[model samples]
Target: MKLLKVSGILLLSSSLLFGCATMDKSTSTDKVKETKNTASEALKGVTDEYRKYAIGEIEDFVKATEAFTTAVKNGELVKAKELYGPARMYYERAEPIAEVFGDLDPKIDAREGDVPEAEWTGYHRIEKGLWMENTTKGYEQFAEQLMKDVNLLRAKVETVEVTPDILITGAVDLLNEVSTSKVTGEEDRYSHTDLYDFAANVQGAEKIYHLLNPALKKKDKELSNEIQTRFDEVYRLLNQQKNGNGYKLYTELTEAQVKELSQAVDALAEPLSQIGIVTEAS
Candidate 1:
């Protein structure tokens, strides 16, 4: 019973870490071809040893995260405290990648309530305020959600189904999503508090390029244009992000621009998140 009550890892950096799982489904368009060619291509470029190195590190982090989240959820306040450091290390390991891409590190800072806007970018100042006031509880709601999410994926990952019909151009959009989602602090800065999302995003995006770039050349000009168009759209939204303002960065964002930004982020989020950092048992 205590296990059920335990909370999540409370990692703001890994905030959107599991959010991208929804990307596993297919896009409506017929132009997308499902292919593992990218992964195969990547295999040649990267040694299996390297894959294990990256993938193993992430798995270890997730396990520690699971323990911490469970303790928090159980309200075993004592147990939860003990797990914080190990849990925090998971985030720390992946920080460099996340920051390089422009993500807000929970280890570094995030916005919370009552925290002055000026002190906004510092370590979850507003988060403490929110918890104190019980306004926006940090990952209070998300703790257990990902446990089920990961359990489901664990089984699926062992024998992941791949097809040649749905080729993702690459997972860069996913990395871009985690990194740039920081434009607005509201998307769950604390969620991505650690570097897990950043690592997964980078790992996943590289496969996209590694797998699809060759097939892209065989595509007709129109198909290439469409792919280019979609890719560019994602790029523009990522680039458009304010230092950390997101939509708020706009002096006066029209409803249209807001919608575009949302759509842009969503468009690339799936591929990167779904298959970004898959691992097979050695």
Candidate 2:
């Protein structure tokens, strides 16, 4: 009887151990599936949000550029000058999407010397007419072409898809754009509206950073916080050069001020680069 009782106890112990192992395996599998589902949903949300933003910004660009072209065609040079910076702001914000359409981007925003002189019919061409030539004469054709290109951009944006990789690359491109052109006062050289482009580019990049912050924070809170802090510092530096609602002319910045801004941008870019890696890991 004692031997039989011992045998029953051992059998019961073995069953409990096997049941516990099975439960653990099931729980781990469920956790992994749950994690994957959560990441998928988050990625979808990011993509959807960026697509909506791109569409709205492109529409706004169309409207603003239309107004700009109208001012130029009407021979209202002063009004066109005022509208120029603001008009380009919308384009700069949605530039990444516009760039996907190669043929249209050059027609709308290409700088002088970027292509053949004959092919340089865009905002910069009009910019030269307004600021350098001091007249809107002979620019009506360019203005008309610009309007058509902007409309095309709006139409194309409606169909374009925004992916996570694009968002990441766009954000980096924005900073590089500022560093290469806007910071050097080369982007809006004729009109001296580089500040407008610089600020707009920063805003564009910041939007991407803001959208990805939640996902980034989960992967590396320290790096995420550093990026946010650096962004704030850059903005603060920019705000010091603000003239009411807009920034001061790019030419107005002192060498010291320019150097400080450049450093801030570099600092931000360093941490910003990590976002793609963190996001992929998550």
Candidate 3:
């Protein structure tokens, strides 16, 4: 049997740290320990192969995002088009790692505005936003304009030997999710239905973490802490009251709340935008 394990940086019961605030549950201290140990048993040695791909995928994504950013900033519409495809590809590659929990997009696909009446695949949202904006004005020309910048970053991700610590960060994310099953089904607030996806992300994180932590544990405590802190920050930001909940706030949100919601979306979007950040990063 292929045993599954949950992954990193998660606290409380939920599918991933972000998204519409999950309905809450009651997982006690003892249950938490039991879950962790079960995951410890399941995830043995799984991180090795997954780590290599995850890091490479992350670096490549970063490069593609860099290219796209440069093109956008330089107003090279042609280069932007070129960057968009590969940047998107890299994002797609890393997705297996990031979207470990619940339905990745979970956007209500009810017959409605904006969402086209077509079957959709997995949701990689930041890309969706960028693609929408880029297509509106530049079309494929935008990608073409980003050629030089794209080429430059592409070379970098190809060569960067990722530190193991980064891998561990990903793994820990999974452990947190898998650790939940030990808590009893009814007690999980996000519902048992979504738990698999939640478990997936957690498992992805856990695998990466396991591969990298041994090499990192003695040397890079700060980096480890930084990842944990970021995870906490992400959860806090996601948990704050936001408008996207049920779309009921469409008319109710004030301009400031609108801005707050916008900012929250962007902040919640950070991990999703890592490749974009790499593209945009100096």
Candidate 4:
């Protein structure tokens, strides 16, 4: 009898402990699921907001391209030159979204020699003619094609599926665009309008960060604040180089100024890179 009683007590204790362990495990699993769901919803909201913003930028880009191309086709060299930087600014500010349409991006914005000379057409081709060749003659065909391509981009962006990865990667890519080409003054080599594109790229990345802020803050407020601070610092540095309604031409910038801007962008890029990981972890 004693042995039986002792066996029964041991069995009951084991069952109770097992039940508690199972309950704890189940509770932890539920919490993780809840966290994941929250993160997903937050990211969905960010993407939706970004989609609306991207559509607006492309709409503006289309209008600007219209005016710019019209000037080029009419042989209004001065007007075309004036419009070039501002018009490209719209495209630069929303480049990642524009890039979604693959070949259209290269067709519309490819630099000189980016493609075969036989196949070359778009803004840079016109840019070279305006500044290097010093005439808009012979550019009428390219101007018309450029306008058509930008309009198509506007139409295609309506169907773009904006997501967290797109936003995050795009933000990073914009910074990279600045660091790799715009900062080096190679993008607008003929026109010397690299600063305009550089500023626009930063603005676009900032917009992405703005959209992602709420979600990111939820996961890591400190990081969100740090990124914002860096953005402000970069913009402040850029402002020092501004000239009137536009920025000073890239050629006018001293090497030290370029280096300062490059360093600021690098500083911002480091923290901005962490945003995706934090949001995904949520």
lDDT of 1 at 155: 35
Error of 1 at 202 (Å): 12
> For candidate 4, lDDT tens digit of each residue in 81-165?
9999999988888887888888898899998778988888889999999999999999999999999988889888988988666
- Could you give me the TM-score of model 1 versus the true structure? 0.34
Residue 159 of model 1: what lDDT?
Answer: 37
Any runs in candidate 1 off by more than 4 Å, and if so which? 1-145, 148-152, 165-210, 242-254, 262-282
**Model 2, residue 99: displacement in angstroms?**
0.9
Query: Which stretch of 10 consecutive residues in model 2 shows the poorest summed lDDT?
Result: 1-10
Candidate 1, run of 10 with poorest lDDT = 1-10
Indicate whether candidate 1 or candidate 3 has the larger TM-score. 1
Question: Distance (Å) between predicted and true CA of 121, model 3?
Answer: 19
Q: How does candidate 4 fare on TM-score?
A: 0.89
**Candidate 2: residue 142 lDDT (0-100):** 94
C-alpha RMSD of each candidate structure in angstroms:
16.7, 12.6, 19.7, 11.7
Question: lDDT of each prediction vs. the true structure?
Answer: 0.40, 0.81, 0.37, 0.83
Tens digit per residue, CA lDDT, model 1, 1-282: 011110121111221433443344343111122223333444444333333333444466568668856765665555554444344444333332323323234323334543455434322442242334433235444455444443443333333222221123224444454446533434334333222233334444444444444434343334445545555675565455433422222324465765675565555454333322231100
At residue 75, give the lDDT of candidate 3.
Answer: 64
Residue 150 lDDT, candidate 4, scale 0-100: 89
Q: What is residue 94's positional error in candidate 2, in angstroms?
A: 1.6
Top of the candidates by lDDT? 4
